[model samples]
Target: MSRSTSTPAAPATPTTPATHGPVRIGAQARTAQRPTVDPVVSGGFWYDRRRTVARVAIPQGPGLLESAGNLHDLRLAAGAADGPFRGDYPFMDSDVYKWLEAASWQLGQAPDGEHGAAAEASLAEHMEKIIALVADAQQPDGYLNSWFQSGKGDGPFLDLRWGHELYCAGHLIQAAVAHHRATGADSLLQVARRFADHIDATFGTPDSGKPVDGIDGHPEVETALVELYRETGERRYLDLAGYFVDRFGHGRLGGERYCQDRVPLRQADNVEGHAVRQLYLLAAAADLATETGDDELGAAAARLWHAMVATKTHLTGGVGAHHDEEDFGDPYELPNERAYCETCAAIASIQFSWRMALLTGQARYSDLIERTLFNGFLAGMSLDGERWLYVNPLQVRDGHTDTGDDQSARRTRWFRCACCPPNVMRLLASLEHYVSASDGSGLHLHQYVSGRYRGETDRGLPIFVNVNTDYPWQGRITVTVEECPDMPWTLSLRIPQWCRDYTLSVDGVPSARTQNEAPAQDGWLRVERVWTAGDALVLDLDLPVRLVEADPRVDAVRGCVAIERGPLVYCVEQVDHPGGGLDDVVLDPSRPLSAKDRPDLLGGVVTVVGAGYRRRLAPSGWWPYQDRTDAERGDHASPVGTGEPVELTAVPYYAWANREDGSMRVWLPTD
Candidate 1:
C-alpha cells in the first residue's frame, strides 16, 4: 500500500464541537477533555464513507422508507395521505426516526467542505419532507405512533413486551437532538421534548399516577431521554432516564433476560436480553453515569463490559450468541455456523464501547470499537455501500438457507424488520464521532482512519491534527500537527493491542525512550510537548498474519484455528476457492502464512494465503462411524482420512458474502 500524509486545509466553519462538561451525553467528561471532529470535516477514510452515505445511502433511504410503509404509517397517523399504516410491523416509526437521524448527520457534514455540495442540499430537502411527516403524524398532545393512532382505538404504553412505543419515542428524541445539533433546527427537538414531557407525566413513581411503570419492554428511551436532557439541559428528562433504569427489575415485567428486566441496571453484572437492547441500555446507563456521576451505574456498566469481553463476544467483536431470543448464551458458547451476531448488535456494541472509552478515556474500549468497526460493523454494509447483512455469522455451511428471513448467505438491501439498514446509515453518518476524541488534557486517536481532526483541547487551545494512512490495510500512520497551542499539550495515539512492536518518531528523529522502555502511557504512545505548525509524528505498526485459537472452553472451535491479520478476522469464502469448498479446507497452523494485496478483489484487500489441505472424497457406500475389526479392516482400520495438501485463501470475515453465495468459514479444521 502507498503511504499518505494529510495536512489541514484552509480553515472553514466546522460542525459543532462536543466537549466534556458538567453536562454531556455520549462520552464521559474526560479529565483531559476532547471533542469529536465532524465527519464532513474529517476527510479520508471517514470522508469516503460519509460521502457515500450522503450521495448514495441517504438518497436511497427515503424510497426504502416509503416502500417499507414507515411513511405510510406516519401519513395515516397524520391524517394526510393514507388508509391503514403501511410497513415495518408494529415498530415502523423507529425506522423513520433512525432515517431522520441519518439525514441530520448527513446535513451536518455539509459545512465541512464542498465535497458533496449538491448531494448535501438534496439531503436537506429530503430531511425536511421526512421531518414534516413525523411532526404532522405526532398527535396534538405529543403522542406519536402510526400503528396505535391508525389501528383500533387504544391508549399508549399498554404493552411493554412488543409495543415499542417508547422505543420509537427514544429514536425520535435522538433524531431530534441530531437534527438540532447538525442544522440548529429546533423543530424536531421541540417534537421530541413534547413527547418526552408527556412520557414523564404519564409514567413515574406511585405518586405520579401512571398505568405502567417507567420501564419499556425495549430499552432505548432511557438513553434517548438522557440525550434530550443533554441538548436542552432539562433536569426532568435526565431524571426520567434514571427512573426507567432504576425502576426495572422490580418484577413487574417478569424476570426474563430477553428484555433485560431481570434485575436493576445497577445490579446487573452481565449482558442479557436482546443483543441490541442490552447494548443500547448499557450505553444509556454509561451516559447517565457520566451525566449524573453515579458511581453505581458506572460500576455496573464496567462489570457488564468485562463479562461481554470475557465470554459472549465473537472474534470479530460481534456479540449476542444465540439466534433464538437474540440474547446471549452460556459463557464461551460461541458457535460459528449458528452464530447470531446481528448487525444491529455489532453497531450497539460499538456504541457501548465508544461510551465506555469516552467515559473512562481507556484505550481498551477504543480497541473493541476498532475491532468491531473493521470487522463486524463494516461487514454488514457491502463495499459498494448498498446491500446489508442483518446477522453476520463467522461460518456459512453448504446448502444453508436463511431460515427466519434473518440470516442470509449474502447481503440484502432491506429486510421485513429492516432495523439494521437505517441503524447502519446513522452510524456511518456519525462515524467521525468515534474516530478521535479530545479530553481536558489532550487528544486521543481511537480508531485509525485517514482523516483530519479539527478541534480544541479542553483548556481552550485551538489544534488541528491531520492523519494520513491506509489503515487496517496499512499499519504506518503519519499524523501532522497543522495547528496547535504554543504551550505543551499531550498527543496520545492508540497502539492497537494486535500490534506488538511499533516505532515512533518525533519530527525526523527517533525520540529517546526513558527507563520505562518506551513513551508508552495509558494504552497510548503519549507525546506531550510545546508544538508548532508542520511538526510531524510517524508511527510504524506491525501487521502480520496470525493464527488464533479460541479459549479451551469454547467447544465449537476446539482443535480449529482462525486466521487474523491486524484487527480483521479472516474467513475462507467459497468465491476464492475454485478447486474445493470451505468445508473441505483444512489448515496447518504451524505453516507460515503470507499476505498478498489483492487489488482486484473485494474492493482491494490484503488476502491471507497458506499451505493447507482439502479432504478427498471417501469411498462410495463406505460406512462412516462404523468400527472395523483389526483382522478384517487391515490397512483401512484408521477412522479418519488424511487429505491431500492444497493452498487456501482467506479474506476478512466482514468481506465475506459480499461475493458469490456459497460456503464460508472463519475457523478451519487444522491438522
Candidate 2:
C-alpha cells in the first residue's frame, strides 16, 4: 500500500505537443439566446449529458464517492495511513487498487474538475508505489506483473488464455492516458510506456527469439496500443496494434482458446464470446482502420457492426447473453431475465460505436451509441448515483433474485474483479471527449448538448463551437459559432436515426426541413453558410413513444412485447402489479405511455400505465380423465382464467429492481 508522487519522464518527443500552434481562447463567448420551439437536436455530442450526467449522475457521483470513502475508511481501520495504497474490492485485495487509479483518472477529467486535485494526487502516489513494487518484483528484464511477480513464479508469461496480465495492462494504460490528459503529468505515462515496451519485446518475437503468436486472449491490448499510438503517433505502436488484429482469427495465438481465435478476425461478425473483449477488439479495429486507412480492416469492422446490431444487440443496445460467463449465447437470443449486460460491456459498446461513427461517418453508429447511452448504460448506475449494478438484466424473478445465487450475475457493492466501477467513472469523467469530432471539412457535431468546443479546425482555422440545450429530457440545441475564420464551412449536424420529424434554423430564420429522413444518407443537415462571430443554428427533434419489437427468432419472449419512448425502453415490474403474473399480462400498445417527472426515481423515470388480465382458480377435477366421474368432473374442474380490469405501472427498463423487490419482466407473455 505505497504511493509515490514522483512525476515520470516526459514522452520521447519532449518538445513536441500533440496540438499544432497555440491554443485559441474565445474572445466573445456568450450564452446562446433561447430559441422558440420547433427544432430538433440530433447527434451524440450532447447525448452524453442525458446518458452520463442526467441519468447516471446520481449513481456515478454518489456510488463512486461512497465506494471510495468506504475504501478509505477501511484503510484507516487497518491502521494503514500515510502510505499510498487503498483497500481493494470487498473481499480479496488483489488488483482492486488499479480500479482506484482508474477512478482517480476519471474524477480528474470530470466537469469543473470536481475532485480533480485529490484524484490526481491519489493516482500519482499510487502509481509511484506500483512502479516501485513492479521494479522490485520484476526479473530484471523490465517485465512486471503484480499477480505473477509476488512469488507466484508461474513463469514469465504463463496462462495467457485465462491470465489477466494484458487486461491489467490495458486498465493501467487507460488510467495513465487519462491522468496524463487531465493533469499533463507524465509520471504514470512513463511507467505505462515502459510496461508496453516490455510487453512488445517479450511477445510477438520482437525482442525474444520465441516464435509464439502474440495476442492477449482478452482483446484489450489492441485498444490500449491504438490509444498509445494516437497519443504518441509512433508507427511501431500502430504496427503492433495491426499485429494483434492480424493475429486474430489466424489460429496463431491459441485459436478459440479464448473464443477470439476460432474464426478469422475479419470473419467474426456478431459480437461473440466475452462482451467486454468483443467490444474492445472492435474499437481497436475501428481505430486501426481510421488511422491506417486499411480498407480490408474497415470492411471487417463494418461486417461485424452489422452482425452485432442485427442479431446480438438488445432493444437497449445492450450485448452479451448468458449470465454465466458474461458471454454471448446465440444470434438474436436476447433473454430479458437471463441477460448479463455488464456495465463495462455497455461502456465498451458505446466506445466501439462512437469510434465507428468517426471512422465511417455513418449515423447508424451514432444511433447505436444513443440507444445504449440512454438505456443500458444508464441502467448500470443507481437512482441516487451512489449505488451501482454490475449486471443490468431486463427482468428479475421475485423471491429468487440473482443476487444470492450467482455471484457474477448479482449486483454487489464491490467485487474482487472490480473493473466496472472505475471503468464507468472514466467514461463519465471523459464524456465530453466523445461528444464532438472535426475533420476540417466541417465541424461534425455528433451529439447535442450545452457545451463549448475550442480547437483548430481541420483547415487550421481557429474554430469555436458553443452548444446550448436541455437534452434527452428535452430536445432543442442552439449551436453558436463564437469564433471562426471568415469562411463558408459546412456545419454538419447529425439527425438521429430515431428522430422522424426535425426542423432546422440558421441565423434565427426558418430553413429547410425533413421528415423520416434516412439516417445514413441525410442524417446530417449540412449548413454551408458564411459564418462569423455570433451566428446561431437551432435544431429540434420530435420525441414520441416508439414501439420496439424483438426479432421473431427470440424464443424467450414468444408473444411478449416491450415499450420505448424517446431512447428509453420501458418494462413492467411485478411490484406495480400485486399477485399479477407477468405471463397472464399483456401490453395495450394503443394506450399512450407518457413521461412523468418523478424526481424520486432515477433522474426522473418515465412511467407507463396499461391494461391486462388475471388468473383465478377453478374446479380441481373437471378434466381428470382417468380418476374423475361425471359428478366429480362437474364439481372439480381445471383452473379458469378471469379477465379483470388491471392497471400496471411500468418504469424504464434501466430503472427496474430499484423499487420494491419483486418479479420483473420486460417481455410479458400475451394471452
Candidate 3:
C-alpha cells in the first residue's frame, strides 16, 4: 500500500473531478488503429511480471510443448519421427502456437528484454526451432494439423462441427503474425499465408464457389484472421474472416448454443454459449466493424457487451458462470462458490474489451479491461509465472472437494486441456500493446503503468512521454512529455469508473475544474495543447477502500458486499485469518478499516485490515430449514456483541491461492 512517489500537487476541490480545464476531453472516436509494436513496459509492477515471463515462463514453454506432445505430434506428422499424435487432443496444436506467439512477443518487448541480450537470444532460438517445425508440418497443399496427419480423428474437414481444424489454424496464423512483427521473419508468415489461402479456397457460401459452407466448433479463427489481415495486408484473409463471422447460427455446427452457433451474431440480444467463444466472436465482430465501418456489427458488439457486463460478469471481471460447458448462465445467475469463471474466459473478456475500445473509443471498455487486468486475468498466472490456473472462482469453500486437474482450485504447471497457461503466456508477453493506443490525433492511456509511451498524429509524427508512478497501488500519475510534434494533440487519461474523486495539476501548477463531481460525459480526462519536451501533468486519484455490492437479484450475494480499492478487487483468504472461521465471520462495517503495505506478504501487496465478527451458530437440523420468526433470525445474525470480534486481513484477489489455498471469498456477509 505504500511506495515512494512524488508528493502530488493539489488542484481543484478534492471532492470534484478536474474535467473543465486543459484536462477536458475530446469527442469519442472509433478508428481502425492498433499498436503494431510493444509499449515500453520499462519498469514497476508490470515490468516485474513481464520480466518473469521472458526469463522464466516463456523460456519454459518449448519443453512443456515437447513434454505435452505438441512438438512430437508435429514431428510425427511431418515424418521426421515415427509416432502417433499426442497431447490434449482437439486443440493440442493451438497451445504450441500460443507458446510461439508468447516467445515472439517477449523477443519484441525491448531492444533486449528485461533480462538483456541473453533472454532475447533464447527467445529467438526457440521461435526459430518451432517456426521451422510448424512450417515443416504443413501439407504440400497448405493444410496443417498434426492430429489428422498422424492418422487420428476422421481425416481433415470431415467433422466441421466437432473438428477444431480452423481453431488450431487460427492460432497458427496469430503466432505467425506476432513472429513476423517481432522478428521481421517471414518463415512462419509464409506457412500462415499458405494455410489461410487453403482455408479461403475450402470454405464459403454457395455463391462464393467454395466447397464447405461451415464454421469451426470454436470461435477463435474469426479474430485470428483479422490479425492476419492486418499483418499481411491481404484483403482475402479479412474477407475470409468476415465469412466465418457471418456463418455462425446457421446450423453449420448443429446450432449448439454451447459452440456460439445458436443465434446469428448481430441478432443476438446478449452474450450466450461458451464464454470464450462468445467473446472471441464478438472481438472479431469489433475488428470487422472497425475495418469496414459496419454499423450493424458495431451495434451488435456494443449491445452484447452491455448485456454481458451488466448481468453475467463477476466482480472480478471474469465471465463464464458454468463449469459444465464453460458457458454463460442466465442473467443474474452470478454465483460465488460455484462460479466457474474460467481463466480463458477472463482473457477472452480482455481481448473483447480491447477490440471494443478500438472500435468505439469508449472509456467504459478500458474500464473493464483495467478491472480484469488487475484481478481476474492477473489471478490466472502465479507471481513467479511458472504455474497457471484454469478456472478462477470468486469463492473457494473450506474443505473444498478435490476435483480433476482442470477444475482443481490449486494452480498447476499444466493442465490436460492446457489452454489457459499458454493463453496467459501470450497475453502477458503482448501486454504492452494493450496498455495504450493512438487514433492518429490523440493518445489514450487506457491502463496506467510506469513506462515510456509513444502516440502519433495524422502525419505519423510520434509523441513520446515518460510516465512515472507506482500505479494501482498509489493514485499519483506523472506524465512527462519527452517529445512531440510541436502542434496540439489530445492526451487523454482514463478516470477509472471505481474512482470517486481526484486532483489534477498541469505543469506542476494547480488547475481548476468546472466543479463537476465526475468527468463531463464519461470516465476520461483529456487535454489538448501545444507541447514541448519537459512539459508535465500530474493526476492524483483517490484510492480509498470501498465496499461494493451486486444487484439484489444476484441472490447468491444479495446481502453480501465485496471490497475494492481503485481497480483491484480484494478477497479474504483463510490463510490470512488462521482463527479457523471465515465462513462464520460477518464484516462489521461500522468498524474503521485501514490500508497498510505488507512487503512481507504475497510478494508485497497492500493489505486491508478490517473488523469482523464470528457469529455463533446453532447446529442445523436434518431438513436444513428453520421455522423461526424473523426477529429470531435477525437476532441470530446481529453483530452487536453477539459474536466474537475478530480482526480480518484482506489481500488482492490476484494474490490468493499463492500462499496456501484453504478458503477464499470476495463477498462477505455484513451486518
Candidate 4:
C-alpha cells in the first residue's frame, strides 16, 4: 500500500465540492457567527492531500475492515455469519463507521476532483454495501454493537465501564449524520435515530429514575448525541446528551480520573484523564452551552481550554503526555521520548477547538486547530495514506526499542486498536469545513489554505474570494474578491501565531488602513471596505526557519530547541545524519539556519538545514550513576571527546518516520 516517493497522480478537477456536510447551526446556536458556505479547498495543499486520500486511504478501508473482521462481526450480530467477535477492543465497529463517514464525504465532494467518474461510482457501490451491512446488524431494539450482539460480553449495558457499547453507537450516529447530510441519504440516519431512540429510552437523567445508572467509560456518545439532536431537532435527543454530560462527576464510574468522572465539567479547573475522553466530554459541554446559551457552561469550557493549553498541550498541539493510560500528566510533565500523544487524541483536540471557535468566534481556537492539523494530526498518518501511527512521539532514540505492534517509533499498516487511520480519513475528506467561517456580515479566514473561499453578508448576498498561495511553505497569499455584495463587508485574515512580522498590501499598493504593519486584533488583520470584483490583496508572511526553546518547566527539553518554519515543526532523522546520529547532535542558534526546497526528498518538502555539533560522550560504564558535582570536577564523564561539527538536516515533523527506520528527535540539545 506504500506509494511512490513523488506526489501521486490526480485527475484534472477544477471544481471541488463547496461543502462537505458542514455543521448546520440551528436556531438554538448562541454563537455570534457561523460558517456560511463551508469554504472549499479547490486547489493547493489540502486538495492534493485529499486526492491522496481518495486514491488510496478511503478506497482501502473496506478491504482492511473486512480482513480485520470488523465486517464479519457486524454480520454475526445480524445472525448472517456465525463467529465470535473480532478485534481486541470492543470498539472495532467505530472504525467502519468512520470509514463510512469518509466514503460519504468523498462521494459528496467535487465529483471527479480526485476520484474519476468510474472510481466514484465504484466507491459509492461499496459504500452502499457497507451501509446495508450496518443497517441489517441493528437489533430489533435499535441497539447495535457487534461485540455485545455476538454474545461476547454477556449482555448490553452490563459492563458499561469497560464495554464501549455507547462509544460505538456514538460513531454510528455520527456516520449516519454525515451520510445523511452529504448524499441526502437518510437510510443510515434512520438506523441511527432508531438507536438513539433506544438509548434515550434506556438511559435516564438523574430525575428520570431509570434502572441503569452508569455512563460509558468513553465520552464520545455525549457529543454524538448532541449532533444527532442538531440534525433531527429532537429535544429529547439533546436532553439525553445532557443527561450523559451531567452524569459525570457524581462518583459514577467510581470517580475514576481515567474515565473523566472525577470532577464536574463546570467546576473542573483543568483538563485531566484520558486525553480523548476528556476532550470529547468537553466538546459535548461546548455543544450543550451553544444550544442552551448557558454562560456558565461556556465560561467553564473556555477556562478548561486555557488550562490545557498552558499546562498539558505539546508544542505540536498534541495532548496526553502519559503513556500508560494515554492520560494527561501534571503540568509540564511532557516527556518527548515517552509521549503518548495518541493520534485519536489529536483529532479529538481539533474537534474540541473547532467547536470552541464556532461558540466564541475567537481566533485562538482556530490557532490550535491549525497547529494540530499541520503537525500532530498530520503526523499520525503516512504521506501515502496507507500506514498510520497510533501515538506521535517527539523523539525516538537510536535503536529505540519498538515493543508494541503499533508503536509510534515506526509506522504500522494497521493497529490492533485502529481508530486513527479512519479518523484521519474523515477529517481530510471534510477539511474545508474547518478552513473558514462567517459572522453573517463578513468572512473570517480560520486555517489558511489555498482555495476558493465563499461566505456571505447579513443580507443573504453571497460573497466569493479566490485565494492562491503556497501557504505553510512560502507564506505569500494572493486573495482576489471574485464576487461580493455592493455593501461594505469585512474580510478578516488570520495572522498565524508563529508569524512575528508580515506585510499586507491591497491592489498592489500598501493600504492606509493598516495599523503599524501588525494584526488588528486577536491575531487577525481586518479590512473593511465596499468590495468590488477583481479587487486583490496580497499577504506576505515570508516563512523563515525559527528556533524555539521550551519553558524551563518542561523538563524534557528545557535546554533544547525545536526548529520551526511557518506552521511546520522540523525534526532530524538518523537517515539524514548518517555521519553522526541525532542522539548527540546539538543545534547552535548563533550559526546560520537555511531553508531549502528539496523536491527530490521525502516527496518534495521544504527542509531546514541548521548548524550543529555532534557530541562524543563517554562510553557506557557498568555503573552509569555519577555525582552531580562531577562536571565541576572535570571528570572523565564530562566532555570526553571533541565536539564534531555536523550539518543537521531537518524535515517537517509530519514527514518523519516515512523513510528508513532510524533515530528521530524534534527537540535537539543546544547546550
Backbone clash pairs for candidate 3 read none
| Candidate 4 lDDT for residue 297 | 78
Reference-based lDDT, each prediction: 0.78, 0.61, 0.81, 0.82
The better candidate by lDDT, 2 or 3, is: 3
Model 4: residues with Cα > 4 Å off, grouped in runs: 1-31, 113-115, 513-518, 628-634, 637-642
How does each model score on TM-score? Answer: 0.92, 0.80, 0.93, 0.94
Q: What value of lDDT does candidate 2 attain over all alpha carbons? A: 0.61
**Candidates, ranked, lDDT:** 4, 3, 1, 2
Give the per-residue lDDT digits (tens) of candidate 1, residues 116-179.
6666777788888888888898888888888888873355777666778899999999899889
- Evaluate residue 269 in candidate 3 and report its C-alpha lDDT on the 0 to 100 scale: 92
Per-residue error for 658 in candidate 2, Å, reads 2.4
RMSD of 3: 5.7
Candidate 4 lDDT, tens digit per residue, 152-181?
876899888889989989989888888887
Output the better candidate (1/4) by TM-score.
Answer: 4
Better of 1 and 3 by TM-score: 3
Lowest lDDT sum, 10 consecutive residues, model 2, at 29-38
